[model samples]
Target: MSGGYDLNLFASPPDCNFLCSVCHGVLKRPVRLPCSHIFCKKCILRWLARQKTCPCCRKEVKRKKMVHVNKLRRTIGRLEVKCKNAEAGCSVTCPLAHRRGHQDSCPFELMACPHEGCTARVLRGALAEHRQHCPHGAQERCPLGCGATLGPVERARHNCYRELREAWSWRQERSRTLVLGLLRRMREVHRTANLVRRQLAQLGGFLEEEDAMLVGAPQGEAEATPEGSMGAEM
Candidate 1:
């Protein structure tokens, strides 16, 4: 983390007391030592890591002896500061506490270019201008879903008509394959129907034979009854 706010960012010079002795910048998250000397929390902690003496008075300091000065921190927060991107054309001036918020949306902030294959870092405000002349920024893709990505150098040479023709040919081949599949399915269905018809014709012949036997059975029984009565009478 930054030890303190940049001294140059302040609208006016801060009082000497508000400066960290270790970092020589405005106190940030100020912490008072046992000797009553204050410095930025980060600066003091770092100084104590190397030597156990206060940066201001050379008094013996310990990590546990540090006391946070919330009032001083709040005071520093209220100081007016220019945007960090001021040199990049940002003119925003706000309280130290609000600097992060302003910087988040500052157009002059540096950002990596969004286009792939370009490693240039550019100010957000100048990205569009950069893209206009970037060798790899502007891109065009084949409209026929050919999966071809064209950069600025290849854009003029791109052949959309050829892509369209290839796409149409692929669709025609796919349609022919689908039609053949359907025709095969229809042939199978016709064969199944013919087999069903043949089975029904065989079943009809069996039913006709059964019906003829049923019709002749009653006449044969009647003729036997008359002969049996005449024999009984004799």
Candidate 2:
């Protein structure tokens, strides 16, 4: 991916066979050509794309003629290597395959601040402590949830009373909204109940009229009592 692995990454000098002639670095993902010559897969691919020939022997090459050297790649993976951040005070050494993992979590590796607007690069291990003093980190909201952004100096001068008051005001407004919603839902439920009661009253009147007709009685005698029905209000 990088022409080839940097020579400085290896614990010791790599074998000449493991070196790519094009990049002059340790072979990564080694590939063999029909000319019986080996080079880094990336290096050989780029060479063939331009010249359609092997760089080492100047022999014609076809894209389909390239063969992967899995055995060599495995051997290279097993080779000892130092962390890429070794120069940044990391002293870890492991197999080449493990080098990437180690670098990923290396405490000595330089990292940009997660806080926005920060351009400083600090060691990964020191990032937490750096954030405590970083200017951009001052954007953190007030601990009381007052939504106030304050720097170190501003935080020292912040009024606890004001923060608490703001929190209280927000809670009061939220409670009012919740109460209003509940009242509206209750009113809708009451309205539905009232409509159902009115339908039952109409059905009762229809049954009374049918009963009176069957018995040959006066409609007034069989009429339903208005007081028997419930009111709309709860």
Cα deviation in Å at residue 160, candidate 1? 19
Could you tell me which 10 consecutive residues in candidate 1 have the lowest summed lDDT?
137-146
For all candidates in order, the CA lDDT equals 0.86, 0.86
Clashing pairs in 1: none
Model 1 Cα displacement at 161 (Å)? Answer: 24
Candidate 1 per-residue lDDT, tens place, 17-87, comes to: 89888788899888898899988888888878899898767889888878999998888899899999888
Please give each candidate's TM-score.
0.59, 0.61
Off by over 4 Å in 2: 141-234
Off by more than 4 A, model 1: 140-234
TM-score, model 2 to reference: 0.61
